[model samples]
Target chain A: MSWMHTIFALILLPAIATGMFRILRGPTAADRMMTAQLFGTCGVAILLLLSTGMGNPVLLDIALVFALLAALATITFVRRTWHGSNKRNHGNPL
Target chain B: MIYSILTLFDIILILTMLWLAWCLLNTEDIFKAVVLFISFGLLMALAWVRMRAPDVALAEAALGAGLTGPLFLSALRRMNRTRKGERRLDSDENREKEHKANQEQG
Candidate 1:
């Protein structure tokens, strides 16, 4: 409920927007993945800012879950890329 | 009155976030871009803390910046190798063509 929290929330908006642009415009798939991760990070920050502004504790749990899922998805992508390259190399002899 | 300091903190956080956004958008190399993205995550965590959300800060640091960044980088490295291999193959084929031409002439 503090003015400080409100101001912080407002500031985060444009930053989040910029990150979203990167997500949309990234040249490589990996760059897009990184941008998506940025989105997740910013989303968590937004939720936290809202939780503080609203004096609610429940949003903390949501943020925690989001973070876990984001990390898991990233790791999965990494594993898939590794396996994909390995398969390509095996078949092509290059 | 008391909120004035909070407002200042908010402005500072916002500026930092914007700087991060610029880096994420303009970085030339994918690897460096990924690193900047991770740093952006950490800065967002700090922003969350300044906003009084310690739980979110902890989660962002652990998952977003810590675990996710490296995962992406590793994946990028793997993908880079495949591209490199294709280029190598192309060069090899070119070399083979040159060798055949030389043998024919000799």
Candidate 2:
């Protein structure tokens, strides 16, 4: 049973590894962002698997935190790159 | 069989980590580097799991990969803005210098 859980977690790693290739070879910023998004989701899944396999509940909270903050990078990207750059485009009045 | 599988998994995880870290350091673009860095964190979290360290995995997933990706992007933006500001300052100084030269000639 425990080995099953371990194998499950181990199997998911290849997906993340593929995502790393995307990050390495990405031509656009958005591609990289998408890959990071993959990281968040996959990380959560891996954490859940480990948590259950090890019979440690604390890992669940970490997974929850991962889910919550997953979009934080996107938010910052939008605010800093898109919104902040617009200031210069509108002809900075100041 | 299970031990062999576990050993194989550990080998792959270690190789993936080393590959990602190398790519992160060698990548030319700062944005790509940031992305790789996040991936590194996430992979590190996986390694923590294999090593039976849940606490470290949690922190790596949340603070390391999650928050830090955006932080690096913003830092890149801040750098560009400052670079632009410096260029503008240099151009303004050049304009002033040219203006003074014109006045003296006239």
Scanning candidate 1 chain B in windows of ten residues, the lowest lDDT window is B81-90
Interface RMSD of 2: 1.9
For every model shown, the clashing-pair count is: 0, 0
Best by lDDT: 2
True contacts kept of 1: 0.00
Encode model 2's per-residue lDDT on B8-31: one tens digit a residue: 788988988998889889877877
Compute each candidate's TM-score over C-alphas: 0.45, 0.79
TM-score of chain B of 1: 0.72
Report the lDDT tens digits of candidate 2 across residue range A2-94: 667768878897888877777777776777788888878987897788676666778788888788988888788767765676566547744
**Whole-model lDDT values for every prediction:** 0.66, 0.78
Model 1 ranges with Cα > 4 A deviation = A81-86, A91-94, B1-106
| CAPRI classification of candidate 1 | incorrect
lDDT of 2 at B13: 89
Error of 1 at B10 (Å): 18
- Going through the candidates in order, state the TM-score of chain A alone for each one: 0.79, 0.83
Clashing pairs in 2: none
